[model samples]
Target: MKYLNALRNQWIAARGWMFCTLLLAGLLIYVMQSYVQLSANMPTRLVPYDLHLMEGPVEVGASAGYTDEDYLTEIAVADTQLHSTWTPNNVESQYARFQNRMTPALYAKVGNDLQGRLPDLENSERSQALFVEHTEALEDTVRVTGRLRAWIGSEQVEDRPIAYRVRYAFSDGVPYVAGFSVEEE
Candidate 1:
């Protein structure tokens, strides 16, 4: 109590210093509160106008049934669109293209692959056989699902492209004809 009284008396006497110290404490508190608020809001950051910047080009025709022509066509379309769009640099455009075009193409390819493979499996005694014995590789037998996003050029708007993505899968375990479809957002 005595030491507090002495400190109080000293502070009262040093009005200038006391005012400065109070101001500094208030400033420090304000700064800390602001920092806390900013951190709290970090997760709520706005989605980028262009999502394509973050996601790479969408892959198409990964299925075993996809012929070289189909693969080449898809790739050519994507490449041409990307090259022509002014906003190819924009993230959103890239993402939109992947979602709209590339994803659907991939799904189709997976379905085709499964359809082709399942018929052959019915004849073979080994259901687990990895790949076609003569032509295709063993790794081609496995069905896979994945999601990806890519940017594509807009024919109308050179500066802005579209962003898109697709989530799909193929599974033989489902009993019905194996297939792939886009997942609902």
Candidate 2:
């Protein structure tokens, strides 16, 4: 309390220029901190993949039985958008960073399953998707099976091939994944 009183007395006795400078500096710091906090909560637009970057299969198709091309196209776009956000070949320490980068809409499609599969996909260098196979279709629920070559290291694990079976349903015209599971191929 004594120190604060002394500082206040000193500030009042200081020259006008010094007092104004100190006041401006304090105000500047407050504005910058507020701006940083505001921007931190806002969603940022980031494109992880290069505009001309091309990797993996150009076409994604199922084993058979899928007739809806529009749905397949949507699935491909979502997969491509999300895959580009996965952590690069750094290490397990940086592997889970991709989950934080996903936008709310993008996250809605695969949030449940993808979040759980981060560990398995940590070392995935790349994949060549066979295609999206629609196995079950109902009024609201649709099931899609995806086959891809998951490369961990230099060696490709193929003996127990894995495929994702995602179940999707529409809520107010927006499709969301109810759940997903990996099936052995």
Candidate 3:
């Protein structure tokens, strides 16, 4: 009877340990499942709290040896603005700035034309301002539509609608002005 009692006590102890182990495992699995569900229900998008700006050289072209659309639009608008708006005092300097933006061939033609008109522009004290109304970026080209107002010696001479199509080409990941034309509208 004493031996039987000892064996019975050992069996109860083993069963108690097994039950405790199984209960702990079940609890862990339930917690894991709850955590997965919570994660699944969370939002994926993040909203930024603050904007940080860093100063550096701007990357103008794409990595795949192509012109970036945003960069092209920005350049086209800026170049057109520079070309369209100028006073007699600044026309030479503004036109000179195009040497950097334009292809050598195009710049040569433009330089000659502007040079020929330089005397007249300066003598008349001409000034022009462009008000940009619409800007569109297309494949390989940008179309900028605006109103051009011209003044000669403080007298308003003309106010007219204007549209410019600026063509761009990439060489070694650098964009250059390939063609520029005034679109008749």
Candidate 4:
């Protein structure tokens, strides 16, 4: 009876603290329940624009059945766009992004070569933009032809025809860049 009395007295003294603890626990439960409801109501598949920079259907990686001419054309255009568009300040970032689309072997060869050119590109203050003229998709290869406009410190330096042919290796329809060649026309 004495021990119970002591515990009762202590609990009375700590009632304010207990009330705060209970309030916080209730708030935490409410927040968690609200989160669960919100998550449950959310869509399972997000729209393409939500996850990608370009607006189109959400691509769920490459598939053998889906590797059609249209797919090759899309890949070619995207590759060339990343390859040919760069400013002095953005060249490094652009190349880094481009690396994601290449095979390990290709990246090892090209990436090291690109690193060597980075200092020159940075120092030159050059920018280049491409306007696509034509794109042809063939078996295992895609060619993108465009007009390339170069600028040196806001002054237009050169504008000419450029073409890039990218060869791809597909393993079960997942494209990995094998190699590429550039031609000036």
Candidate 5:
């Protein structure tokens, strides 16, 4: 007991070593807590919650990979019911000249139409179940191939099947389609 008391008295006489030991222990605890939090928040895989963002919709142009000729041909073939004298060559020239002339109204109309169809395509319970099961297997970029039919004035214009590939960036748990292109199938 006398020896232990002597050692304690000597250690207390110095004081600096004891303070340093306490500070180091506190620092170690703080570092360990930060490490745990960082590991907890790290992403394990790409999920829908990782993709939904509210950036403005992108525009489609000739440089988007579809040639003027291709766009003209698609428009013409789709608008067979229209009795216009406009030819594919003429439309191609117009599109070539106005490649950068995308209007907000045009994009809005396309987005509205797409939104309307999404309920039918994406809201099915069966499809959702399938999506849940195999979503990991789906590519980050998706290629959607479909045809669009719209009524222009009194004419029923059925556009040919156009395959579009869209690259999506996942944000906020939803996949937002960011860029699009027409693919030749």
Candidate 6:
């Protein structure tokens, strides 16, 4: 009777201890799961980008070669930059006209060409570059042929428009005139 009573008491103690441990473990798991769900539902804060600018020679222009769109863009820019407003009366106006249209090296060459003609500058008018045709000479070079109309203030300078071809290159990271030639066509 004593051995049987001791065995029953030990079994009862072991069962009670196991039940208490299981209850504690379930509570701990529930608490941890609820904390995770609550944090996930909260709104997250976003961080902004930090872009600090530095000073240097601002790199300009597209790459050496051109896509179809790039080729058209260079042609348009070159036309605008090259079109000259004929300043017939003043040396300052003539110089300024070339200075505006041509690059530094180009200006040096064309300036000499126009230097002696400043006195007769008023004999001409502003040139309107009406684009006619373009041919890609190289990967980065374009030969643009166009009709050049001269307008003196409000009047046309001639009865017929002049045809001109300009060889332009974007090889040096910028679209610039390589050569200018006039044609009767």
Best by lDDT: 4
Candidate 4 to truth, TM: 0.67
Better of 1 and 6 by TM-score: 6
Candidate number with the higher TM-score (1 or 3): 3
Residue 4 miss distance in model 3 (angstroms): 99
Q: After superposing candidate 2, which stretches have Cα over 4 Å from the reference?
A: 1-14, 40-144, 150-153, 157-162, 168-178
Which candidate would rank higher by TM-score, 3 or 5?
3
Local accuracy by lDDT, each model: 0.38, 0.49, 0.81, 0.82, 0.41, 0.55
**Per-residue lDDT over 154-182 for candidate 2, one digit per residue giving the tens place of the 0 to 100 score:** 55553333444444444433344444455
Judge candidate 1 at residue 180 and give its lDDT.
24
Candidate 4 regions with alpha-carbon error over 4 angstroms: 1-66
TM-score for candidate 1, please give it.
Answer: 0.21
Best by TM-score: 4
Q: Write the per-residue lDDT of candidate 6 for residues 16-60, one digit (tens) a residue.
A: 999999999999999999999999999764222322453423333
Worst 10 residues of 3 by lDDT: 45-54
- Per-residue lDDT tens digits for candidate 3, residues 57-158, read 334443553445766787888889878899988887777776578888887778688678777877767799988898898767999999999998879999
TM-score on alpha carbons, each prediction: 0.21, 0.37, 0.62, 0.67, 0.26, 0.41
Model 1, clash count? 19
Can you rank all candidates by lDDT, best first?
4, 3, 6, 2, 5, 1
Model 4: per-residue lDDT, tens digit, 73-149? 88888888887899988888877777888888899888888778888987887999989989987777888998999
Model 5 off-target regions past 4 Å? 1-138
| Full candidate order by TM-score, most accurate first | 4, 3, 6, 2, 5, 1
